[model samples]
Target: MTKSVIQPLETLRLAQYAVPIPCFVCGTDNMFDAEFCTHCSAPLALAHQADNKKVHPRLIAMVGPSAAGKTVYLGMLMDMLSRRPERMQMLARGAFSITLQQTTLAALARCAFPPKTPSEPERWNWVHCQMRRAGKRQTVEMIMPDMAGEALLEEVDHPHTYHLIRCFLEKCTGAMVLIDSIKLREGAREQDFFTMKLLSYLSELTSNDKAGWRKRPIALVLTKADQCRECMNDPAGYARTHAAGLWQHCQERFGRHKFFASGVAGTCAYRESMTEGRVQVPLRIEPHGVIEPFEWLLSELERSGKKS
Candidate 1:
């Protein structure tokens, strides 16, 4: 009898079973007990698993220019979810998915922006949230990527940064592209070109099957509406008149797109105090309709799951 030799591939495959792993969302590894991804903190298993068979974990991309209130919006969204039991009851039963929750919450507590040390053009922050919706506990994994506007305008020849954008867009299920409403009002001509370029690039990427991005839902969100007092006074009217052009462009290019407005720090601009070396209160915090777009996206996801 010849001695049996274990193949390298077989050895590698066996290493996978060594650990009793936890769900990426809920941190529960037991099949009957696990309902979410433990490591990443997303729902991977659930009691009503059959109903959600077609439900795939979605990547919600939060895209915006610097200081456009993306970080604040995210912090407030998480804060809102934490306080509203009824709103989050549909999510998994837990305080937070993982340690990341503490970091996010801490950043919010400081009333300052999250860590945004400039190194790369794109940086991602993930938040795992459990909520109750449609009579079932659900897990929502949100991916927030902040890309520098300068980088967006940079030529695609910058291979590393360009590839990062491509990768994020490819995996994204839905996107919230934020535009600074105040900047628009300030006659910032550069923004128009940036927005057009970004949208056009994304459209091209999604249309190309070779690029692996197709059929992704996108929401064009206008941020800092509070600064535009006129628009804040009547959001519906502003969206109809001023925002209509952008909306139409998206419809023509992406086919599936919606327009929305959100304000995280209801103030106009930040003012630094001379003596303190700290920033003075720039504006009042008046968040409005910040959650609606996300809610709509979740509803869309649910509907898609049901149809499937």
Candidate 2:
């Protein structure tokens, strides 16, 4: 019954699996073909791309509550940067990176906002791009993820509920904390409280004064400012007046922080939907104050890099 046949050895394949690729977010070792990190569920494509490019990308956290428009802001920011190379150009590292921009622009083209980001770690959109200024020779590699608001709140209240959020926040070099301008203008204390809690959580991540979040740049953006004239006029003053607690907390805890107002929709109207109740639709596409905060954050990062 024994039949001997010539077979080629798979030594190369065996050797490939001998070495484990470390997860970029949580540093968990996994097989090379693993799609998501076993520990945190972050896409392993980030790790592969970084390895291939031989670059260490800095993580930027987009932190906010539900309906704060993190997705819209990030999408608009990436799309703008990708199109306009005169200021700063962003080149996506992989095919997966373009998913965020594609989905965002497509939905906006239909006069609707993108669907809510699911709370699951695997469902989050992580963007890895190389950014280069028009006049500068140096390029900065960065990774940013669109995280779900409810999940962020849960992690803030109960640490480790989402391993990806905790790991990413701890390692993030900079953060943009978005608060809904419309909600604050309507006298909602929930936005103010949630942002404060998020900041407090960030500050407690590290105890070293030199390396703590106090020294890191924080962009406190009031989104949906087109509808709030006062916010668009002066974001800092608006934050001070409307969100006193959040303003005071930032003043006390964070050292390098700035407030900026950004709006994506020119106007919005509500419409009844069969699947989802009433949904807000954009009447027109207009971006205002979208780049200033990002520009400031980049400058701060560049300065920090030079200092270090």
Candidate 3:
């Protein structure tokens, strides 16, 4: 009779631990089979993709207060870019990366925006894709996370509260700061304070002096500008006139910054639901000024540095 021998359990475990996978966000060592980063809870799929391509992807952060229209803006932007493919094009790197675009489009087709993003880093939809300009050969690998506004505020007020947000912001080279134009137009001091706090927090986090928040490019986007045509006509003037505090802060602290206005909802209606109460629904989809800020940011980092 032939006898079979089994490998030692300790040896098997040792083999499993031999190669360590470092998180792309937090740089924490994880088992090769880990599905999420232990430190920051970022998807391990990003790490695996990075390893497979042997390329470091640039990170951009989209941050704003709760109800700032981050979800709608991001969802609409991705859907438009992926479908239009006129000026610039984006090709998602992995299958998991397209979930945000897919879900957002599906919801929009039903005249509703995507639901609020979950606060958990692992649950959040991360956009991992390559951007290519018209007639350009080399593509830029980028990862953008749609972070929760509440989680971001919590981290800003209390450091390390959201390790994923903090670590992601610390490593991001650019940021899109979304301001609710509807609130600003109505003179909400709370909006001003929230933006001020976020900018100040970023200033402290990246105070390298030589190349910190001051040098990083920021696009102050006034979302929901369709409600007020004046915002779209002249974004800079709108900022200076309405959000004076935020405008002044950017002028003094940041070196490269610009103002933009974007609106995804063509028309809206408030409807009462039995279960969810009052909710706003989009009547139609008409994207405006959505691609300008993104294109400008990419241009600044890639070729043209518009420092104003």
Candidate 4:
């Protein structure tokens, strides 16, 4: 028998995947096998579903310090919107998108708040949904990620560490900055400084005057408003006094912005636990002022007809 020499494969069998897929958020081209954008760490699935040739999806971010209740507020908003018919309806795109809503509402139903979001980028939950607004011909494709507060702070302190945060801020349609109202009411100045840092960080992310935050509608959300009656009463006023730095930053830099309060817990009680030391348990599920900021942002986006 004659020995036959086989030719070596010169190219990858799946050359199409090797061509690179551009990240929708950061525009960074990544490998097809990448589950998340290599540069920004945002889910690659976003890029898969996105059709930028047509109308681009609008992205919004929920940011706050650790324990600021970003998860609770988003979860509550999703839950409330799901229950109410004829209002904004969110249809989650991927199965992963529903995880945040599912876990959040389930915890609330059990009289507990959702657990803290993990720091790992891959572990983070992202919301990709088509928001069906009443009276609108086309539904809005919305992308909102629940980012870790520590990660946000880290990015603010040291830029480029979290490319996803920077990319999102640069390309985001709007942002909802959450401030723990309970902490603010209790005379916490850290929140003020942190928010100030956040505003500055966002400002420095881009230099284009036309693309500045002046046009992006920002909503300063006072989360856990149920703990404080005054916050629920007057969120803007609360910002003016409690978060002077943030208030002034918005006034000076941002054109379209609003202050709002939201809470998922009605009344909370101190519960002693072995694993958690002491935890705050919601006595009842009362979502107050949860939808106002979202509604306001949506309306603003609708009227503006996409960011210029």
lDDT of each: 0.55, 0.94, 0.87, 0.85
In candidate 3, which residue pairs clash?
none
lDDT of 1 by residue, 176-266 (tens): 7777787777766455455666666666655455433235566667777766766655554655565555555665666456667777664
Best by lDDT: 2
> lDDT of candidate 3 vs native?
0.87
State TM-scores per candidate.
0.66, 0.96, 0.93, 0.91
C-alpha RMSD of candidate 1: 8.6
**Candidates arranged by lDDT, highest first:** 2, 3, 4, 1
Tens digits of per-residue lDDT, candidate 3, 1-308, equal: 97999856676677878899999998999999989999999998999899988666889999999889888888778877788677888888898878888888899899887888877777889899888877877677889988888888889889998889889988988999999999998999777788989999998896577667888889999999878788998998998999899999999999899999999989988899998899989888889999999988887777523342
Per-residue alpha-carbon lDDT of model 4 for 1-308, expressed as tens digits?
99999998867757877788898888999987789888778888888888543557899989989889999888878777777648777777878788889999899889898899887777888888778777677677789998999999998998888888888888887899999988887889889889889987877777886777777788999988887889888898998888888899889988898999888888899999999999999989888888889989888888777544
Predictions: Cα RMSD each: 8.6, 1.5, 2.8, 2.9
Tell me how far the alpha carbon of residue 44 in candidate 2 is from the true structure, in angstroms, after superposition: 0.6
Worst 10 residues of 4 by lDDT: 48-57
Q: lDDT score, residue 1, model 4?
A: 100
Best by TM-score: 2
lDDT of 2 by residue, 1-308 (tens): 99999999977898889899999999999999999999999999999888887667999999999999999999999999999999998899899888999999999999999999999989999899999877988789999999999999999999989999999998999999999999998999999999999998999988787898999999999999878878988899999999999999999988999999999999899999999999999989899999989989998998999999
Model 1 ranges with Cα > 4 A deviation: 1-56, 89-117, 121-124, 130-162, 207-214, 233-245, 267-270, 273-284
